[model samples]
Target: MTWQLRRAHEADLEAIMHLETITFVHDAWSPTMMARDLGDPACFYLVAFPPDEPSAVEGYAGLLAPRGAVEGDIQTIAVAESARGRGLGRTLMQALINEARKRGARLIFLEVRADNPGAQRLYERLGFIEVGVRRGYYQPDNVDAIVMRLDIPELESMLVETS
Candidate 1:
């Protein structure tokens, strides 16, 4: 399947929240918070979808990196289960990493569920290393979160792409 990536907009909130709630079943962000973040200028969010159905948001990712900021945070990333393993997650992450560079972030931080080895492996492949752990970070579920950090190099060629 040919998927395209694009900056997420207000119109995509319904679709994004749909995937968000399903993908992060135990700890999905409230729609209100997501809407606020989507409108925030400091946040860069992207959605992936088949070109034929623009409203079908198969996956979504977000980053908080202000211009000239020293650090960035990968706020969230979720891909529909059906859309996994075709490199969509990595593609979303690559775009966010590139956006972090463009916004002048020296490093990026993210947290993964300790139980999620697949996500941990992906972050590792992207050069993120575990730095710490947030015990019981995922509420109710009480799952520990593995904090990871990635020091981004000063590379101008970290190009942003939509294809």
Candidate 2:
């Protein structure tokens, strides 16, 4: 399925929150925090929906890269169970990376659950290297987070050379 991507607005809060609770399961961010991030000037959030059902949000991602910032962080990303393996995750991630670059970020960082190898693999394919581990970073689950870093210019250069 092709997903329609758009800058998340106030109206998307509920649909996004529903996916957040379902996807994150034991470690979803609070609705208050998500709402605040959506409104934050330094953060860029995107919501994806199928062309047929514009009101339903099947995936979403957020980036914390203020304009002129030297570094950025991928705050979070998720896709609905039915939407998995449909390239939506990759699309959302690439979009976030592009946004970070446009905002002047030279480096991008993200943290993935130690248990989620699929997401880790995706990041690795994007040229993100594991930097460190945050012990017990996830609340209520005690899941460690694998910290990863991607040098934006470096990855872009490599891609250009390979292409």
Candidate 2 lDDT, tens digit per residue, 1-163?
7989999988899999999999998989888999999999999999999897879899999999999999999999999999998899999999999999989999999999999999999999888999999999998999999999998964456464443
- Candidate 2: regions farther than 4 A off: 154-163
Error of 1 at 100 (Å): 0.3
Q: What is the Å distance of residue 124 in model 1 from its true position?
A: 0.3
For candidate 2, the lDDT comes to 0.93
RMSD of each: 3.6, 2.1
lDDT of 1 by residue, 47-72 (tens): 99998888889999999999999999
- Give the winner by lDDT: 1
> Against the true structure, what is each candidate's TM-score?
0.94, 0.94
Candidate 1 runs further than 4 Å off: 156-163
In model 2, what lDDT does residue 133 have?
100
